[model samples]
Target: MIKLIGILIVVIGFILKIDTLFTVLLAGVATGIVAGLDFNQIFTILGDSFVSNRGVSLFILTLPVIGVLERYGLKQRAVSLIEKLKRLTTGKVLTIYMIARQIAGALSIRMSGHPQFVRPLVNPMAQAAGLSNSDELKESDEEAIKALSAASENYGNFYGQNLFAGSSGVLLIASTLTQFGYNVTGLNIVKASTIMAVIALVVATIQFTLYDKKLNKSHKK
Candidate 1:
């Protein structure tokens, strides 16, 4: 059907590596025209869809603010703050953050996350800690530290959130089990989640300790 022309346009545009937003908008407009909709109708449809899913665009609002903060030395300040703590190491910093993240998530206090917290603050601080006693960090080593910081947030959130009584994960588990003919309760899910979180914390602590040892040995050489 001619109406399916938009799908072909999207596939071609992506394969050609065109700008994603422009490609989608062009495809949508073309599809509307082929379906006998005028420009006004097409524009109205686009506006309504955007309004319904505006939450996805929420991150755009934060980018400018983050850029302004960076321009004002936000990352440098984070690094400087970490450098003042002579005994902190990259592994120790991330491990502490992981624990704090897990605890906060369990309490349903998700004020810290990758974009809002880790990128703007945690990654820089962790990098500074790694570079504190060393001559310089290799590009690979810097990237590894950033990767670990991001992983810490993910690990903490995954295992921790279910501990909250009203967490969506608990509901999903209960709902899924019910669908499968199991009468699982929220309290049971919370109990299981809490146990899993404890195990995760222990494993994370051990990994961090080993990583710290490795970093120290490398710095000494």
Candidate 2:
């Protein structure tokens, strides 16, 4: 019961905007002790997990860089560049950005859109698409657009990344399949990845077509 309370405390604390890492660590320590982990062992596990994921902390580097870039109007330039292309709609503009970002990720170039770049470009472009100037969006419309944007990015990476021989997932998949008596090789996996990429591209094309129609209606309004 005490261990369960610790877990509840950690979860509730985070949801309530309390210090999350401390809460979670405290809960974990309590749970580990309850489960008979000695203090040393608990610390060791914690250290291992922390060290293993330390690279994720590098994301912090982006925030200041984005802020500096945005202050200089990088995002404005991105938006303005697209705006000048009178044929581009908000959805189309965002779609292109998503595709390009994903492709970069697959190639291990690793890029992201956010407060520094996305808000300056995507948000304004969408506004230009004839959405009400009001700052609010209908929940349904927001959800739909968000889903489309997420899907575009995910599909781009999914279809492109596996092409690399060095991709860990390719090796993992091949190994797992071999265990199941499948005779898959690295080359075969690459071919399969190519096929999947083609499928994803087709789906993206269809979505773009639909979004184009929506943009037309928006412009007409």
Candidate 3:
């Protein structure tokens, strides 16, 4: 019963619009105290969790760098580069990025496309390509294109990461199955992940192509 205090604290703190990091830490400390844990022990657990999920920490560094780049015309540069390629439509640009992202994931390369690429590069490229074929881009069209651009990164990362034998997802799946008395290995998960990634790529390719045709038709009307 006492251990559930953390959830209550978080809910209340969030509702009050409190400082997020401070609220969470306060909740942790309160919960630890109630659960008979000393401050040192509670901090030890938090520190361990932080260390294990270092990816989240890297974003702290990457975000400011990305912000600095954006301030200096990173997005403008991407749009300008894409505008020079007269034939590449919005869908085609997104498709190419999706494929590249999938391959990077499969090879165990860590690429956080939303922050590192999509927001600053792919989305602008897509908008430029959209403008090339349309007389005037509507608000609805812009929003739709943004959704599709974001989805491309999600599809690639979600389906392709497990293709790596050492991916956390693969290991988790294998371990969970083994706990249930099944004999599954990370290699087995990787094999299945490959098939899923292929299917996803094929499906995404069709979707992007169809979108281009539809978008072109609508613009011509």
Better of 2 and 3 by TM-score: 3
**Candidate 3 regions off by >4 Å?**
1-55
Query: Roughly what TM-score does model 2 have, to 2 decimal places?
Result: 0.61
Query: Which candidate wins on TM-score?
Result: 3
- Which residue pairs in model 3 clash with each other? none
Give lDDT tens digits, candidate 1, residues 74-118: 999998999899899888898889888878877888554877879
TM-score of 3: 0.78
> Global CA lDDT of candidate 2, please?
0.68
Question: Candidate 2, residues 1-221: lDDT per residue as tens digits?
Answer: 76576778787888888887888888888888888889999999999999999978778887887778879987577656655666665466556765675466456665554544455555556544424332344565556665565566566666777776557878898999999999998778878887777677777867866875764555456
Give per-residue CA lDDT, model 3, range 127-214, as digits (tens).
Answer: 8999888767888888888999999999998998898888889999999999999999999998988888899988998988888887
- TM-scores, each model vs. reference: 0.74, 0.61, 0.78
Off by over 4 Å in 1: 1-53, 110-112
User: How many backbone overlaps does candidate 3 show?
Assistant: 0
Q: Local distance difference test, per candidate?
A: 0.87, 0.68, 0.90
How many clashes show up per model? 0, 0, 0
